[model samples]
Target: MKTFKSNVELVFNNLNSEKPSRNTIGILAIKERFETALPRSIPLNGYSLESHQKNEYSRWLKINTVATKFKNYKAVYISLKHPDRAPGDITAAEMRFVANIADHYSGGLVRTSHTQNLLLPLVHNSNLVSLWRELSSTNLSAANIDTMQDIICCPGFEFCSLANTTSIPIAHEIQNLFTDPDELQALGNIQIKISGCMNACGHHHIGHIGILGVDKKGEEWFQITLGGRADEKLQLGKRLGPAVDRASITSTVEVIIRHYLSERIDQQEHFLTTLDRIGIDSFKEAVYG
Candidate 1:
């Protein structure tokens, strides 16, 4: 497979070989040509690895689910969960099902969120239960929207050319660790964002628990950040000490969580608030120690 650099070179070469069209090719035309000529595996962004076929289906599904109305529609929101790494990948069959629900219940309207989840806006109160049941059957419903298990992760070395390590698997492991609903509820609302590199495509800088992947002498290492939040009161997370190995990433997170649990004033107080009150040194010591 050719790299993005090579693909650019190919575009220039092809442009040079062809007769000048008004002395320059249109930007859209150039983009189209480059896309057609390049291999599908070439990573352009986090969504580069996503299947186009699935994306098209998702578009159709979202377009059809707009302005749906039922009683108490104002109070209901339908959230569609996309797995880590592979965001917005609803199958054609699944899309049809969701679209049918939207058409029947919602005024055939759906909204795609920046968090990579789909929202069925204004779902009627009467249809909420049926909608959720239908969505649950297909396993497309989001369990924890603003909770800890609702993780945000970037496409790491598996797809991005700029990535230093694999992030998706780590995200999956972290999610698995919080499988028990009670345990998750105890932890309260926590945002964990993982990026394969310092570019912060996963919005790690604004996560309550931010993990940035780095390369240390060809080995994968992760740097942890604490106290960041992307909500109403936004703040950048503070970096803990040095980076840790991939194997210890999950354990390190556990230590941080444990430290918070022990140190927190109450369950109502969020992890960020606790970190702010106690400071980063305490969490750093817990992780490194």
Candidate 2:
């Protein structure tokens, strides 16, 4: 929305003169402003890893789908995060490899996301396991989509000329903190978007937890935001307090996460829900204190 002025308008289809809503936001403002499809921030309601249990295929089923919606189905996300590469960094061979997977499994259809992951919107559910195995062979099957490890970061000073500070390294540092899959899943659905500069390429502005890179006296600093969303109920995240030095940013994020874990009613209550229920002040105290 920053780069593009409102080119479209969205509203509920059933709304009428008798029963009307003037709120031109949230689901009504999806895309140009219609609620046809949901953004990544809004996943299937009541969806969680526990429901799928230990069955990898079952989990993938939730991420993907059987022949239904479109030509075949939809695969929510195929993580690009790997130990050997930065997030979304796909090599030539990997590109060809994913292309082949799409050709074979998705009717030659795929979609990339703002979060820097790929979605095969036409994969058959029956082929979920097969596709996952193929992607796993190349280390693309992290199954950590929308989890803490599924970080969305822009190419910072390392790549982008407009960047004030490096973003990939900080993303890596945060990723390293939660190397355990179980621990990440325990945290539940959350988003951590980082942008290298004010261009807002990485969408840190609306992340469940946002990290924005800045430069101060030639030193790198980061400001954080809480409770932002780009989903059906769109909201601009509030500034948590102030910027922190680069070295401490990752640890500060951990502190916020720990605070959410401690205060949540249960694992079922997501980070945002907990933050919403109690208030952002609670988190500000936990981090600033």
Candidate 3:
């Protein structure tokens, strides 16, 4: 149970192995120590305790455990029970499970995706209950992706080194604006990615509707991109000509969708396919009109 001043030091020590027998054991020693030191509780809502700021890396053994547990969950809960409408904040009890496991197993290494979701990195092949207990504690243990609202967005002004306007608020606006769960489900596999800058930190490069903010001489503007992905079939989005002012972003996005709906060959045409067939130029003309 040796505590290093920095988690990175802990990781390096485990990997390098100062002790002979512990060489194979690696960071498992740290994890075992951490587990003993922490108290256990059932999570009220699924929230991740792992913080992803390069604090530490997980040992192979712990990663295996976490990964294994993930596959066994019946369902992963995306949101937690909160007093307000904000959906994903889990309770403190759940927070402890995430923190203890994340800290001990991975040296508290956590990674947040562009979508504002946290990843536990590795889970192992073990009893489903421990996995369920870990996830259930945080309210993150859910098993449905078919109808889930997988929205991708950037921070905009929040914590970003560069940003002119707020992008998070807009994302929340769209999420709240879309009232019908069935409508979202029917849309089926739509990816909405927003960015505060042209650097595309929010992974606008891979979203169906990629929103990028541009500096028009001095005023803030936005560029629209269509048909992009990073799947096995990776492709970059084509930008429509010219950028829109800050106030026009929401309407412009909706207008682009309207164009897609009006010109789509069929209900089966997704936003990207529709963009491909019509092309970005056509969409630009239609949207700007």
Candidate 4:
């Protein structure tokens, strides 16, 4: 007594034509059938399952840096985040340095992270110390991956025509407040994303702390948000309150950070975890008061 569409809905494990939370309705509808009808072919190229052995140099080199080991090689994260430099900016000389490193240590293979950092994906474990030393020599060995200073920012009014304010100075000001490496490590993976406009080129929507610039009666104002995440479990941040003046934005951020430090259960507890436990209410009180 039912139509063809009614039976199709039953195939997707739903009585109604409602979509899945994680995937599109079209994907859910066609995935199983599409895979079942796909042609299988052998890959022309072959690879080894053999893994590389652990080496001594990688141990020390990986202590502060994210030299993640794998079956074939170790992947090293090269931080571009420096206090004086713009969040994602790298000089021509630094680019050449990284290129040389890639050729020498990573088999000429390198990768860029979504967060605007570089990664040497095919680094040999034995070459890690040499790599680290060379990086440190040129001040390219910034180890602040996933820390507070590892900011994701958009080129605001400086470069973009659609911006509400300048973002580079704001980022630098915030970075200056947290210079102690020990303190940075303790903060533990709180991302700060800043957008010049609503286009969200900086991915501000999903930062642990999101800052957006807005034009207010010919003046620049910033709006802050909390609890965003850009990961496997992606989430958008909630607005903190009304936009604050440019001068007060950095101080407001500091208050929020101090509040998290005060409320965290332990040093190892991540900022996101602390936010989850204590809730954004604590941050609200700290920033507003």
Residue-level lDDT of model 1, residues 1-289, one tens digit each, is 5798887776777667756444256754676766422111112233221365344334323322344333234323333333342543467897788788767665676666766566766665445445555665777655556566677788898789999998888877787777664576678878889999989998999989999999999999999988888779988998898989988999899898889999999999888889889999999888887
Candidate 3, residue 113: Cα displacement in angstroms equals 4.7
Runs with alpha carbons beyond 4 Å of true place in candidate 1: 1-71, 75-89
Instruction: Write out the backbone clash pairs for model 2.
Output: 9-33, 10-33, 10-34
Clashing pairs in 4: none
* lDDT (C-alpha, whole model) for all candidates: 0.71, 0.78, 0.56, 0.78
RMSD of 3: 12.0
Error of model 1, residue 202, in angstroms: 0.2
Clashing residue pairs found in predicted model 1: 64-108, 65-108, 65-109, 65-110, 66-107, 66-108, 66-109, 67-107, 68-106, 68-107
The residue-by-residue lDDT of candidate 2 on 1-289, one tens digit each, is 9434433333334244344455534335565654434112222334343434447655545543334555434554778874446888888998888888887777677788767888877565446556666776887777677788788889999999999999998889888888776687788888999999999998999999999999999999999999998989899899999899988999999999999999999999988899999999999999988
Models ranked on TM-score: 2, 4, 1, 3
Per-residue lDDT tens digits for candidate 3, residues 161-236, read 6886566665565554343544554455566677888777777777777778777676878777777777787987
- Of the two candidates 2 and 3, the one with more favorable lDDT, higher being better, is 2
- How far residue 168's Cα lies from its native spot in candidate 4, in Å, is 0.9
Compute each candidate's TM-score over C-alphas. 0.71, 0.78, 0.56, 0.77
Supply every candidate's count of residue pairs whose N, Cα or C atoms clash at under 3 angstroms: 10, 3, 29, 0
Of the candidates numbered 3 and 4, which has the greater TM-score value?
4
